[model samples]
Target: MKILYAKDFNRVLDFLTINLDGVTLAFSTAENDRSFNRHKDYGINNLNSIVKDFNINNIKYLNQIHSDEVLVYRNDFENITDKEGDALITSEKECAIGVFTADCVPIIIVDDKNKVIAAIHSGWKGTYNSIVTRTLEKMIDEFNIDIVNTKIFIGPHIRQCCYEVSEDLKEKFIDKTNIDRDILFKGRNLSLEECILKDVREFGIKEDNIYSLDLCTHCEEDIKLFSYRKSVGTYGRLFSFAFIK
Candidate 1:
């Protein structure tokens, strides 16, 4: 229930200090924001301010290939990639991870017991490739994190009510995973949220452990959720971020 908006960023250090358990979760909105995310292949320098304020020195980022590849950030200092991938996970508290999004679903995973966290960017491409499932697997294999005990928060994105797609796109979603197809497309509704939640359930994550923001970025124009589809071509992105405190 703790949500931080873009305008409140000036108080980042103060916000993080108010510990609802030192796991400060914050994300940027499309409004009152400043970031150099003009290039699709880069992150914003403004985000560096957040990282510094949060006391994170080791930052991890990916190129976002849109495939099922989950990048693991292990080192404290090194050159990061600009390649295309979907997700990132790390147990290092020394840094924060970044995921830029216009309308893509950004996810945060926190295993409070083990002090592990994950940041994932899931679009239709990532969803079809089972990126959520892949993230769960990586956590188990690498950090010995118990999926049953982990908590996940699904951030705002385009909801099925407005996220219309072609039959070809729908077909790819169906072929890529085993899900209740009826909920996927109800005449014109393509339930990406439902599909992702379903995949999370399939990965043995408890229903209670999954939290859905349930807000449609496309529908909330004034709120600045940054709808790439709505912008057509000209717009900046809201960088979704998460870290261990």
Candidate 2:
């Protein structure tokens, strides 16, 4: 795996791309790049140019309603612009998929053997609804991907140290998933990463194949990544993209 940083439109961005079995899979973070924001139309245009620099064509994005919905991208699927979903999966090499997040988790899954890649946006609602597990299940049922061989990358998000949630929300995760309350909650705070990891492991993804950046968006003040909790209003979003070349 190689980490690289570049300037896009005068804004610095960091990308993590890995070459495995002759396929290049990558995800990126917006480092002090406020222009990469996804909420504004200009921000989306800026993101398109940044993705273009990666030599990716026809990048697919979602309306991202924070639901458990996952879209299986196919060449025949039309209206990519209006698609509303939180996750996207595709085996087509011509199509690259990405998700936007500020403090929410951005997950990328790759099946190198099958050349299938998926991009997931998992917020608290999506996580509580088992979005990652659902996406993996879709890959298995539709694409026949080997869960054990699939590589999962959990990108930068708000970590447990700064991801404090309400007691009701913490209880919801514990009671709903049957995960240990002690494991999910620490002093009235919930660990979203741990919750997602627990579900992924339960789905039979190998421990070693699962990797996490473990960088907290809220804590990394010097990194200049956007954080909704840090600044509720006027905060930007970080884009995590993945595709097979």
lDDT values for all models = 0.71, 0.78
lDDT: worst 10-residue window of model 1: 13-22
State candidate 1's TM-score.
Answer: 0.85
Best by TM-score: 2
lDDT of 2 at 5: 31
What TM-scores do the predictions have? 0.85, 0.89
- What are the per-residue Cα lDDT tens digits for candidate 1 across 47-82? 556667677775567877677888777774365556
Deviation (Å) of 158 in candidate 2: 0.8
Q: Give one digit per residue, the lDDT tens place, for model 2 in 48-84.
A: 7765676766777788998999989888887764789
Top candidate, metric lDDT:
2
